[model samples]
Target: METQMGTVEDNEGNTYQTVTIGAQTWLAENLRATKFQDGSAVNTGFIPKDDDANLLTFGRLYDWHDVIDERNICPKGWRVATDNDWKLLERAIGISELEVNKEGWRGKNDIAITLKAAQPDTIFKKFNQADVNKFHFFATPAGVKLGNWYITQDMYTEFWTGSSATEKDAYARTLAYSWWNSHKGQIRRAKLQKSNMFSVRCVKI
Candidate 1:
């Protein structure tokens, strides 16, 4: 695909790279905004205790509540990708839309291969670089913050979806570097508690 690259600046003046994927335009980088578009701070969002340097690389991890906040976490004219929005993006990239709306572990299209970034050999032995920017998704392994100190940095990354699976649980997508498959990574949708902090990737409205 002929991907068009661009840039977007958040209300706070933090700029992010943007990429056009099929019919949609997305933030090529994970969101690192500390405030909502309305200028309200996301006080509940977790910023790793002492890891300021990694924040730029991984972006801030936010709780589901922070995502659902009416103030809006995304920049103006953009919003967090909804579950249906994710489905549309996947189908645009050729993944079947059959399981797109399913609650947990949906799809069998090797979605991870096309979305994740190429890792260094030190991180994974059989890393595949073929699809790193094939579609310009450029997903990174930013990991998650689940109450304990940041765990699995460079090993796993998850993005919060705007859809809520239940009153207390929400939908999200995850990408992981696994040793089981000879260090290959995978991506899928799953439900998570409202309190779990994960990365956010926004889509243009």
Candidate 2:
């Protein structure tokens, strides 16, 4: 538990937060990968091709299709997190995946909240954004709109994991202040689209 802190610079010179958890070093935020570590598009759209399908929010929520790609989307030495990797973080925090979205914060499983950055003043470019970024994760609204806005009671912070929920859908990690202060998981079943925004935190091997 002696955590070492530092920064990892991407090819674009983007310095991301880094932390040591257990024996693994992890990014304190999600991977907003706009392109492959080599500068290729990461978004999988309708036709699932180039930058046109690239995402603006949450930086493109990839499915198993893109994840399993051996080319690897993350920077050199880093790759997108798999479902199993997601599980380890939950285990270390003493939380269960099934209970992640139970509509409230559980003190026992609030580690995810601790990682979220304080809510900003604006979300999805909307005015007067909310969220205190209590955790350094600094999760922005990133606004995952399904139908008529899919925001829950406290729709301030949202996050996405590398694991897919189903064939076309994937799992998203989130938390709210309105509830009892716990972390939650959401399964997105729609196709990938740009315009949505989210934060990225990575884990190192």
Candidate 3:
């Protein structure tokens, strides 16, 4: 597959690099918009520890309510990445057709490594400079906001898919370091609470 690159600006004038992986074009970084396209504020977002600096690197975490809002958090011509969008990315990165749609952790041949950003930190047990982050998706362990507490700042990262599994839960994708000592990484598909806060990535519509 050919990889194409470009840039986009959101409502708040925040610019993001975009990468074309397979047939879809996705934001290379997590979204950091505070307002909708029509100039409406998204009041549900929260920054970790009230640090405004984190907005540029980690982006703001938002609940599912803000994700599916009609005002649209993403820039014009783009939308929050959906469950099928994630599956397409998985298949493009080497996951088999059979495993791409399965729930729980489903990836093969270091797929997680290919999707994560190559950070020089101890959060990952193993690091491969050559094969990691081949697509420039730049997945980071931005952690998440649960209720009033922020946890897992550098351990793992989860992105909310625009697909809903139920009224109270929605689908999401997770990338994390394996518990055992190894270079291999893991990706998971799970349904989480709609109130839980997670990062968002936009896909070109």
Candidate 4:
């Protein structure tokens, strides 16, 4: 039988799920693509050309509009995932919610730790236990932007959720590393932080 590509680990471990989708073995990690997958020239000025590559460990942040542009971003066998694709993952991990958590959060709540990357030092603190990730998600708090204004570093990992708002400011989902519960996910926009450059993680769809 074919097993799923990803593995489950606690937030304290450094493992991430690398799945094979459509003949491609890919990381479940956030895309940190500095260049469009085809090696084409992409604009890095959105982020400082000199930002420490290591700290932006996932990949260069792309706006929702950019991800929408088919010109390029994902590799040959892959495409940037859609909202439906993410929903599938959430379902797989039993994180689905037709309603909301006590916090009135929008998306599912069960998969937070499963999606968190192992960073014990950075894991959100809840009750008394720091997340051991327990889901191989290794989610990190890469600071984001408001059009060149870098904002919150130690608290948020606002990522492009492949969904959009009605306006120019793109829609995104943020996971707070300092908080105790994953139920409090925040969704925000691009124009709100056009200055902050963060990380990327693409899904194979």
Return whichever of 3 and 4 wins on lDDT: 3
**Deviation from native of the Cα of residue 165 in model 4, angstroms:** 3.4
Runs of candidate 3 with Cα error greater than 4 angstroms are 119-127, 178-184
Question: Residue by residue across 52-152, what tens digits does model 2's lDDT show?
Answer: 32233234333345554566656677766554565565554445556434433433523444444443223232212222222234443443433333333
True lDDT of residue 111, candidate 1: 52
Per-residue lDDT of candidate 4, residues 1-205 (tens digit): 1224663222223344566433334456665454554455556424423366633354356566556556556554456654455455444445445632212244433335545554333255332124334434566666565565666655667766455545554445566655554443332223233223455555654
**What is the TM-score of each predicted model, taking all chains together?**
0.88, 0.58, 0.92, 0.65
Which has the greatest TM-score?
3
Ranking by lDDT: 3, 1, 4, 2
Give the whole-model CA lDDT for all candidates, comma-separated: 0.77, 0.46, 0.85, 0.49
Candidate achieving higher TM-score, 1 or 3 = 3
Alpha-carbon lDDT of model 3: 0.85
Off by over 4 Å in 2: 44-69, 96-111, 119-141, 145-156, 178-199
Clashes of each: 0, 30, 0, 38
Model 3, poorest ten-residue lDDT window? 177-186
What CA root-mean-square deviation does each model show from the true structure?
2.5, 7.9, 2.3, 7.0
